[model samples]
Target: MSVLVYTENWDGRFKKLSNELVSYGSKLAEMLNTSTTVLSIGKVDEAELKSLGKYGADKIITVTDEKLATLDNRAYTAVIAQVVEKEKSGIVLLSNNNTGKAIAPRLSVKLKAGIASGITAVPEKTSPFTAAKKVFSGKAFAKFVIKTDIKILTLAQNSYEIVEKTGQAAIESFSPSVSNDLIRTKVINVEKQTGKVLLTDAEIVVSGGRGMKSPDNWGKIEELADLLGGATACSRPVSDEGWRPHEEHTGQTGKIIAPNLYIAFGISGAIQHLAGVSSSKFIVAVNTDKDAPIFEAADYGIVGDALQVLPKFVDAVKELKSL
Candidate 1:
């Protein structure tokens, strides 16, 4: 049995998370002494399928139909389940995105495989097949072992490194049994966000809180993010206050991110917010409160007013870049 990665894409282009999944899938396949196969649904082009080789997919399986252009939880789940069964895949890899979140649980029951979501690390050994996963929203780590022959794993976004392999793989076309009536989810419109990197996949994130005072004051945060080529995020109160969209909010109740660097300005670092971003590699907190809870999790802490500190920090960054 081989490892299978459910490669997710939008508008026929591969999403960044697909490479991260394939990276881990390829390593896992090597450990198991098997090849990694990538399974794509919908009408993705052949050239794009061959590019999977750069991300460690030994073979690409394209399952296409007109009905699959848009995501339908029921239809997609049925098709993926059929593929896993047909291939007798031992480990099924998935991205922990909207699509993977919708289909993983359903596919688990269909395949009778154990599932571990938000996984952070690869398997340590082979006999028991254990994988390390983050628990309590990044506060803790736990190990899970699959007793069944089939195993399903939904990896956290940006959790694994994308390993590149040279050479292309031959794309194989497949006609999976599908029901058009069941795949009734239709896409009416698509709205793309402008000028902001996605927070979930961003390596560096600069965030502000209610202390930013007003929406007009967001320029400093934006400038810092732009200079670093990263994303801008905000705390819950800022989103609730309508200074930013709810999508940019990060906290226990909001989206979770594990960027390489997380910079917090004026954020008090409530336990809930910390729970979401505690996985960041380095945390730098800038707040007036010397005893703010955020300082506890921050690798570096600066106690000062954000309004005074922000502009200076941005200027210093610009000056350093110029030098």
Candidate 2:
């Protein structure tokens, strides 16, 4: 049984998340003593598809159908399930993003595969097929043992390193029969957000909380994010109060992000907020209270009024850039 990675493309192009999945799949293939095969479903270009080899993909399969461009849970699940069977893949990998979360359950049901969702690492040992993921909202870890012949795993983002290996993948075209009845979702129009970093894709994220005092005080927060070329996020309360858009909310009840660097200003670091960003590589917190919960998790912390400290932080970044 080989390893298969179901990579979802964005606008006919792959994202860094896709490469990360390929990298993880390649590692799993090595552990399983098999080859790596990637299935790309959408109207994607050949050149872009082959680029996955840099991350250790052995073979690339493309299913070019205009109807499959948009994600329909039923349709995409069928397509991936079909590929898994055709390749005789024992382990199927996907990202824990919106698309992955949407289709993983359906694919699991269709393939009768045991699913380990939101896993942060590869199998500790594949003997009994032992895999571990964060449990209880990242407060702890739990290991799962699957006896099923087929295993489906959805990996958490930013958890695996993307490694490059020498190989030029052989490309193959796949045309799976997608029943029209399975394509139930219809797209009317797409409103694209332009000229800002996407929170999910950002390496660095600057966030503000209710401690910012007023919505008018967010200028410095946005400026800091812009200076660092990162995305802007907020606590859930900030979103609920309409101080910021709901899309910027990051928490257990909202978006879960694990950026390389997460900076929190005016956020008190409630457990709910920590649940979302606890996985960040580096956390920088600035709050007035020294006993704020954020400091416990922060790699670097400044205890002072966030409003007072923000201007200084902005100036420091500007000075460093000018130098």
Candidate 3:
């Protein structure tokens, strides 16, 4: 049985997260002495599907249907379960995002497989498969063991590095029986977030909290993000105050992000907020309080008012860029 990785596409395109899943699945397949196969749903183009081979996908199977455009948990689970059985997938991988959270458990139950959600590392053994994951709202870690015939894992975002091993992928299409009755949800409208970097896909993120004091004082946050080619995010309070959109909210109660470099301004670092961003590779915090909880988690800290410090940072970066 080959390793199966479900690659989620966005408007017929793949992102770094998709490449990451394929890479993780590929390495896991090598550990298991098997091949890695990718399953793509939705309307992805042929060339885009083939490009997955660069990330170590040996074979690609695609399913395209208009009814499958919008996510219906039941229909998606059925589709994945059918693929797992047909391909005899010894292991299945998916991203631990909203989509994965929606259906991973159902897929496990349908296929009678053991599932480990939010797995952060690859297992070293196959006999009594073990996986590492975060627990207690990122306050601690735990190792979970899965004992079953087949193993299904939902990988946490940005946990694995993307590696490129280019090879021509064998492409083929699969037609799963997705009848009308299976789809319980219907898409009435779609509001696309365009013209800016998708926060989840951004490697670097600049975030603001309530310390800025006013929504009108957000120019430097946006300026810093633009200069660094990163996306902008805010704490829950900023969103709740209507200073920013809810989509930009990052915290345990909102979107959980793990960017390579996370720069925070004026944030007090509440436990809920820390739970979401604790996984970031590097955190730089600028807060007025030296004792702010964010300082404990930050790789680098500056005890200064963000309102006074942001303009200096912006100018320094601009000067550096001119060099």
Candidate 4:
């Protein structure tokens, strides 16, 4: 049996998470002494599909259906299940992002496979197939083992490294036994936030909080993010105040992120907010309050007003770059 990874794409381009899945799955396949295959849906470029070979996919399966372009959880689950059975894949891997979170549970039920969601590492022990996962919003780690013959896993974003290998994956066309009737929901229109790094895929993130006082003051945060080529995020209160979009909110109740570097501006760290970003590799907190809870979680803490400090910090970065 081969290892099957669901490499998702949007607007004809593969996401960075998709490449990580391929890399993770391929390494796992090597450990299992099996081949790795990637299953993709929608209209992705043939060259892009074949390029997954460098990340360890031995074969790429593309299902080009107009109806499949819009994400219908039920329809996508059905297609994935069909592919798993056809490939006789014993292990299935998916990103634990929005789409995977939506479809994984449904697909697990359809395949009668034991699923482990939000796993942070590869299987620690292959014999028992134990995988490590983060729990309590990144506060704790737990090991989970799937007893079912067919195992499904949803990998946490940015947890695995992408290693390039030399190989050319063969691209094959796949038509799953999917019908239009299976699509219970239809997407009428799509509005996308364009020209910014998706938070989940960003290595560095610059975030602000209610301490920014108003949406008009977000310029500094955006400038920092732009300089670093990173994404901009906000705490939940900022989103609640409508100062920022909900998608940019990161906290226990919002999107969980684990970027390489997380810079917090004017954010007093609540446990909920920390829970969301505690997994970040390095955290820098800039707040006027020295006792801000965020400072306790930050690797480097600066007790100062963000509004006053941010401009100087940006100027320093610019000066360093020029030198």
- Per-candidate Cα lDDT values, in order, are 0.87, 0.92, 0.91, 0.91
Model 3 C-alpha lDDT per residue in residues 1-323, reported as the tens digit of each score: 89999978988899888999999999999999999999999998889999999999999999997778889999999998889889999999999988888888888998888888998888857778888788877888888789888888999888899889967799989999888988777788998868798788788999999999999989999999999899999999999999999999998978888899999999999999999898899999999999999999899989999999999989998999983
Name the weakest run of 10 consecutive residues (lDDT summed) in model 1.
177-186
For residue 309, model 2's alpha carbon misses the true position, in angstroms, by 0.9
Clash pairs detected, candidate 1: none
**Which ranges of candidate 3 are over 4 A from the true structure?**
none
- Model 2, 1-323: lDDT tens digits are 99999988877889888989999999999998999999998788889988999999999999987778788899988888888889999999999999899999998899998899999888998989999998888888999997889999999988888998888999999988898888878989999988899998899999999989889999999999999999999999999999999999998888889999999999999999999999999999999999999999999999998899999999999999993
Name the lDDT value of residue 110 in candidate 4. Answer: 95
lDDT of 3 at 104: 85
Top model number, TM-score: 2
Global fold similarity of model 4 (TM-score): 0.96
**If ranked by TM-score, best first, what sequence of candidates would result?**
2, 4, 3, 1
lDDT against true structure, model 4 = 0.91
| 1-323 per-residue lDDT for model 4 (tens digits) | 89999977877898778889999999999999999999999888888888899998999999997788888999999999989989999999999999899999998999999999998888999878899888888778889989999999999999888899998899999877778788888778878879988898999999999888899999888988999999999999999989999999999989899999999999999999999999899999999999989999999988998888899989998998893
User: Which residue pairs of candidate 2 clash?
Assistant: none
lDDT comparing candidate 3 with the true structure: 0.91
The candidate with the higher TM-score, 2 or 3, is 2
Q: Candidates' TM-scores?
A: 0.95, 0.98, 0.96, 0.96
lDDT agreement of model 2 with the native: 0.92
Candidate 1 TM-score versus the reference: 0.95
Q: Model 1: per-residue lDDT, tens digit, 183-288?
A: 6667889889766788997999999997778889999999999998899999999999999999999988898998999999999998889988998999999999
